[model samples]
Target: MGINTTKLKRGFRELFGKTVQAFIVQLRMETGLMLIENTDLSISEIVYRVEYSYPASFTQAIRNHYGKTPQALRCLA
Candidate 1:
């Protein structure tokens, strides 16, 4: 926590092979996917749970990451 912004970014990128933003998006998308697959929660609820402000954005993220819509993914599950 004491590190400067540049140093923190560098260290994080070196350790994680991606920027902090990418890592966070990856975590959110993964969590969203899990919820979609295993829970009965609605798409809007899942978007809120994943910290997205809009269902459309969350759906776009899911599509970008998995090449499937949330509903499509849920159907597979």
Candidate 2:
């Protein structure tokens, strides 16, 4: 089955609560995956494109959530 945008919107509303930081972090997670899966840009470029002020913080968050480095995930595809 595929995700519907309506369901996805509702899901995000429920999961992210009302905190702007939580919402932005979730957005970063999604954007990071899109960058890794769909583009040839390096991880640093992805970090900047996502508006993360600290590359190390973004890298750590990505690693903590996905259990893999961006470089490692790139190799999987």
Candidate 3:
């Protein structure tokens, strides 16, 4: 697209009610949660599947979004 970066950011936020980064993080977290809940994949595997290079960072993001660790969420599922 020929859209300016600033204008794209503005339009994205206006349309989604969140910054693009936040939206991406949210998508990653949601994917991670779905995997945790429905699959037998390990936490580290899920982390990588969500494009996170560091399991610690992915764990922290999950905790922040779901108030639980991936393992904890998996146990619940």
Candidate 4:
């Protein structure tokens, strides 16, 4: 899929109170989806691409957003 720059930008503007937080949230969401779709790479590798502070943070965010663990999602796919 392509980047929905306009929609994403507008989403950030509305959903995030701050620009930086919005950017990071968007980064995390986008990267999380990439991680879900592509199983070739490890979660640790994907964590960095998403700019997560640590693996735990990435996993926590994934869990919070999807209501499923990364491993669970991977297995389902």
**Candidate number achieving the greatest lDDT relative to the actual structure:** 1
Between candidates 1 and 4, the lDDT winner: 1
Decreasing TM-score order of the candidates: 1, 3, 2, 4
| Candidate 3 error regions (>4 Å) | none
Inter-residue clash pairs, candidate 2: none
Ranking by lDDT: 1, 3, 2, 4
Mark the regions of model 1 whose C-alpha exceeds 4 Å error after superposition. Answer: none
Number of the top-ranking candidate, with TM-score as the measure = 1
Poorest lDDT segment (10 consecutive residues) of candidate 1: 1-10
Please give, for residues 1-77, the per-residue lDDT of candidate 3 as tens digits.
99999999999999999999999998998899999999988888998999999999998989999999888889899
lDDT of 1 by residue, 1-77 (tens): 78899999999999999999999999999999999999999999999999999999999999999999999999999
Candidate 2 lDDT by residue in tens digits, 1-77: 49997787777778766455678888889899889989999888999999888889888889998998888888887
Worst 10 residues of 3 by lDDT: 38-47
Q: Candidate 4, residues 1-77: lDDT per residue as tens digits?
A: 46687777766677765575657786787777777677567877888877887989888888888888777777887
lDDT of 1 at 45: 98
- Per-residue lDDT, model 4, residue 16, is 69
